[model samples]
Target: MNNTYLTTEELAGRIKYDARTIRQCLKDSVLLEGKHYIRPFGGRKILYIWEIIEEDMLSSAQSNLTIPMANGAVWHG
Candidate 1:
């Protein structure tokens, strides 16, 4: 894919967030592990896919889209 892999610090810089916040807050919530990023060589170090994150960010910015919940799914209000 010739895509560029970015470290936590690099991603934080691009998003203007602290690396710790990305790991603690965004990881597994907004930015999923396998889908949006991966650990290097199965090591502890995580590398985020810039292209995927960019695409996701753009998609999230679209206000017209809504995730449809399945029947019996938890919903408040």
Candidate 2:
């Protein structure tokens, strides 16, 4: 499926993260430029592919271990 490209601010709003963080962290480490995001041709605007970013975010979440059912106890996975 082809998803519409979104601006940095738009992407930030969808992911609930600051645009600065997206640019600094996910842009290169996870969301690669050109593949996941890119600068508009001959323009200063940046566009992010929603599906790619969202999928990457979900994948990252799955890889990280988060403690569930906290009752004054910590569980390390």
Candidate 3:
């Protein structure tokens, strides 16, 4: 239970994205609710799981390093 919980603004600072963009664009599209964030105690406030999102970001960055090949294959770079 040592996960780093972050407010929207705090997360925006760490990830260099606008808090507004995160709320409007990425909230449900990219960042999922239960997995990446949560509304504690059925309240309105949101808290993000920093470690999970960081890992996903790193993995997504690594995924982009691959070269797309023929027949739906990808050459990992």
Candidate 4:
């Protein structure tokens, strides 16, 4: 897996998200530590793994295609 490590600003440009939003909102909520990002040398700087983020983003989007039914079931169309 060729994982691309991206800075917050670089990722923001690629994903069309504001750097502040990525730092404040998506940091610990959607983008998890160690899994989606890494703190090199245990420093404050964060490097996001683009491949992992893309995979998760696509997977989540695909999952969202499934419709929830009232009878406790999902409808995939």
Top lDDT prediction, candidate number: 3
Q: Tell me the lDDT of candidate 3.
A: 0.96
Q: Model 2: runs farther than 4 Å from truth? A: 66-77
Compose the digit string of candidate 3's lDDT tens values, residues 1-77. Answer: 78999999999999999999999999999999999999999999999999999999999998789887988998996
For TM-score, candidate 2 versus 3, the one ahead is 3
Q: lDDT, candidate 3, residue 69? A: 90
Model 2 is weakest, by summed lDDT over 10 consecutive residues, at 68-77
TM-score of each: 0.76, 0.67, 0.85, 0.83
lDDT of 2 at 70: 55
Per-prediction backbone clash count: 0, 0, 0, 0
RMSD of each: 6.9, 3.9, 3.1, 3.0
Give me candidate 4's TM-score against the actual structure: 0.83
Task: Rank the models by lDDT, top first.
Answer: 3, 4, 1, 2
For candidate 4, write residues 13-37 as lDDT tens digits.
9999999999999999999998999
- Tell me the tens digit of each residue's lDDT in model 1 across 7-53: 99999999899999998999999899888899978899989999999
Candidate 2 per-residue lDDT, tens place, 1-77, comes to 88889988898899899999988887778788878987878587778888887787788777786676658775555
Q: Model 1 — TM-score against the truth? A: 0.76
Residue pairs clashing, model 4: none
Better of 3 and 4 by lDDT: 3
